[model samples]
Target: MQNSKLLILSSVWVEPKSSAAGGRMLQLIKFFQSIGYSIVYASTASESEFAFDLNALGIESHVVQLNDSSFDGFVSEVQPNIVLFDRFMLEEQFGWRVVQNCPDAIRILDTEDLHCLRNARKGAYKKGVLFQNEMLFTDVAKREIASIFRCDLTLMISEFEMALLENLFKVDRGLLYYLPILIENETIGKFDRRLSFSQRKDFVFIGNFLHEPNWNCVQILKNEIWPELRKCLPDANMLIYGAYPSQKILQLHNPKERFFIKGRAESAEDVIENARVLLAPIRFGAGIKGKLLEAMVYGTPTVTTAIGAEAMYGNLPWNGFIADDNQAFVASAVVLYSEEEVWKNVQQNGFEMVKERFAEHSYLYDLQTKIGYLNANLKSHRQQNFIGMLLQHHTMQSTHYMSKWIEEKNKK
Candidate 1:
């Protein structure tokens, strides 16, 4: 039997150290490689200094162009058995081309999170109104949902989002798959060696500042949470760390205030493991947070909002406290920071949560089974998805011609 070829169409090159999305993509890539698949990664986005070296892993990396017919020829050449779109936007850009070139290939969409949900919550937060499910009805939602319907299967990071799509949008359950970010058993074993609560000092907040929610979160930490928190614990410092820190973010750093803005940790695990408590006062966002999960792996308990803790922890207790109000958030951080016994207990909860929720064994096996089933019954699967077929037809006609026009315009 020939080794199956898998092509990944990514919006950006993976930079696992920079963001959770990058780490999640690396996890997926390693999983497919383990299953003995030959992988090819293609992206239109420019590579950064931090981008992962796919060539080092023996994976072919290609620089693809938008609205270019050359992708049609490239897809035909690779002729992969599976084509994974890194996100809905990637699916929208290259999905039609894949269908025309490799009709037999299984199409999978990995939704890092529901962009529509995040956008709606952000809109509500900006307007100072409570976010409602009704707010989810936007043009972005329409585009994202259409991309979901067009794919054979979609990997959802949040269980809450899976339920939302099925109940609210009435999307067929067969098209959605729950696959959160997975942690290897080897990484999970390092929890015992992490620094004890006493050995660690200061509260740390780390994220990719390019993400709007992270920037918003930092502002909340600076203006609302940190001010009260510092007053309570006069000696303790608030350390902010992330990638792509803008001038505005840099200006927030003040030695007199004991609030430091550190840019780009070379090792996120090292920074997180040494922190006494992780602070993420996320007012609005979607999906299970990568930062929270990383804190768990490193035995660093966190105090975050309900929005930050959403769809994480499942029925399990949070690693630390979940507080929405600024006062409550400050109080929780203080308590988690001061009480040694409470800190130790919550740290254990984090370890257990990681073992139960993110163990890679079950998810990887299930993924294999899903792909096998889809490979054998692909024709029947497509037949059962009438909405998908309809959308594919219309999307192909519209996107196809529009792309052709863009390609012609670029020449002129």
Candidate 2:
């Protein structure tokens, strides 16, 4: 029998070393490959220097243009059995083309995180008010939720967001699938080989700086968290690492204050493994944190806020500590860094979290089974999702004309 074809419409080329979303995309590619799918990855975004080479993995890579009917012919020729959108925005942009060209293709949207939820929280944080579900009713929410309703299945990274969608947004439970940041079993096994507390030094914070939440976390560390933290542990250094550090982020580096902004690590695993403690006091964001999971893989304990640890551990004890207040966060960091026994225990918790929650073996089979069932009953599935059908019909019509108009305008 011929292997099935899967076409992925990505907003950006995969850059696993640069961002968690990139890593998640890579994981999804591997999962589909393991299920005997011949994959074709196409993106409208230009390739970055750090982008992973999908062709190296035997996956076909194509550069696709937005608002162009050329994509219709391209997708029709590929005729993928499954068409996965990297994020909701991609679905909104290219979904209609895919639908008009290949109606039988099972469309899947990977909601890397709930952008609506994250944006709502960011807006609330900016206003110095606690985030409420009512805050979620934004223009972005309308577009994102509509994108969700237009797809056959949407992969949700956080269980909290999944419940929020079902309860707050009134989305059907059948449309959402829970798939967290998956770690390879072999990677989990390397936890024992990570540096011990005595061998490691300094406090580390790593993320992609282009992300607002990460940039905000860095500011919190500099102004609110680090001054107090440095006084508590004067000898230890605070190292910040991330990709695309703007001038403002670079200016935050002060060797005199022991707060150094080291832009982008060569290897996330290497730096994370060497650090005694990873600190991320994320005030607002959605989705499971990739850096925190990387910490678990490297046996590096962390001190993060409740938002950073949300839906990550389930009922399992966190790898280190979750503190919302600056004082409490500093206190946890000092104790975790100072006590070897406590650090070791927390490190063990990380290993356990990896083995139990994120190991690919636990989720991959279920994902495959779900995909198989959806493929077999695609027509009935679409029939049952009335909202999805309605949104697909109406939204795609509007989006289709808008795209064609843009394409014509561009020609002039």
Candidate 3:
């Protein structure tokens, strides 16, 4: 018997070694392959160095152009049994066509993060203010919600978001599935505390500067948190690592400030494992913090804000300190840096948390079972989702016409 055909629509290229999202997507594909699925990965973005080698994975890859009729034919010819959208925006763009041509296929949306929440928080940050209730009613929410409605199911990474969809949005429980960050298990012996203490130095923070939240958090530290930290812990170095650092970010680097922009780390694990303590004083951000998770996997404890610590610990005791206020954040960093016993305990806590929650012992099996069960009953599942059907119907009518219009325009 032939394996099930699965088509993945992507917002960006998948390159595990390059980015958090790309790496996650690469894992998903591998998981699917492990479960006997023939994959077809498509993306609207053009190829880049970070793009995954789909050929090596034995998965068919295609470049898709937005607002073009060619995508309609692409789906018709491929006729996959399952279609996974990488993020909310990709769903909004290509969702209807998938429904139009491959109505029988199960449409799944992979929301990397709640864009609505992130955008709302960004708006609040831009105004130098707090998030307002009115922000939820903005356009992003509508598009995001509509995208969810259009899909058979959505893969939510954060448990906090799963609750928001249920309590706040009244989203149907059937429409959302909780799928936390997946990791490969490496139950390596805990790092030697003495060796860790002797090798560790400086306060470290790393994130992709392309993300608004990281840029904002770094600014907060430079202007507010780091200055105070330096006052208390004199002679301490605060080295920063991130990809796509802007000219604006470059301006913040200063030896006198004790804040050095070391650029992107050659290996995320190396920089994090070597750090004395990870420092993130985030005012507002959504989803699980990858830096903190990496810190945990690396046996490094961090001091971050409540938002940074959200949904990550999973009732497992945090591996390190969680502080919201600037002064408190500084104080925690100081204590954690100096007290070897305290630091050692947190490191052990981190290693244990990673092993228990994300050690990938059950990740593959659970994902395979749930996905296989859904696949077995895919038709009935779609029939039960009336909203998905309705959204698919209209998406076909409107987006289909607009795409034809663009294709015609392009010929001229």
Error of 1 at 18 (Å): 0.5
Clashes of 2: 0
What would you estimate as the lDDT of candidate 1?
0.94
Error of 1 at 240 (Å): 0.7
Q: In lDDT terms, which candidate is top?
A: 1
User: Tens-digit lDDT track for model 3 on 141-224?
Assistant: 888988898887898888888888788777888888877776675434444432377688888988888787888888988998
Evaluate residue 142 in candidate 2 and report its C-alpha lDDT on the 0 to 100 scale. Answer: 96
Off by over 4 Å in 3: 132-134, 187-195
The lDDT, on a scale of 0 to 1, for candidate 2 is 0.92
> TM-score for every candidate vs. truth?
0.99, 0.98, 0.93
Candidate 1 lDDT tens digits, 114-212: 999999999999999999999999999999999999999999999999999999999999999999989998988887888998899999999999999
The lowest-lDDT stretch of 10 consecutive residues in candidate 2 is: 185-194
**Model 2: how far is 332 from its true place, Å?**
0.9
Best-to-worst ranking by TM-score? 1, 2, 3
For every model shown, the clashing-pair count is: 0, 0, 0
lDDT, candidate 3, at 87: 86
Q: What residue runs in model 1 are displaced by over 4 Å at the alpha carbon?
A: none
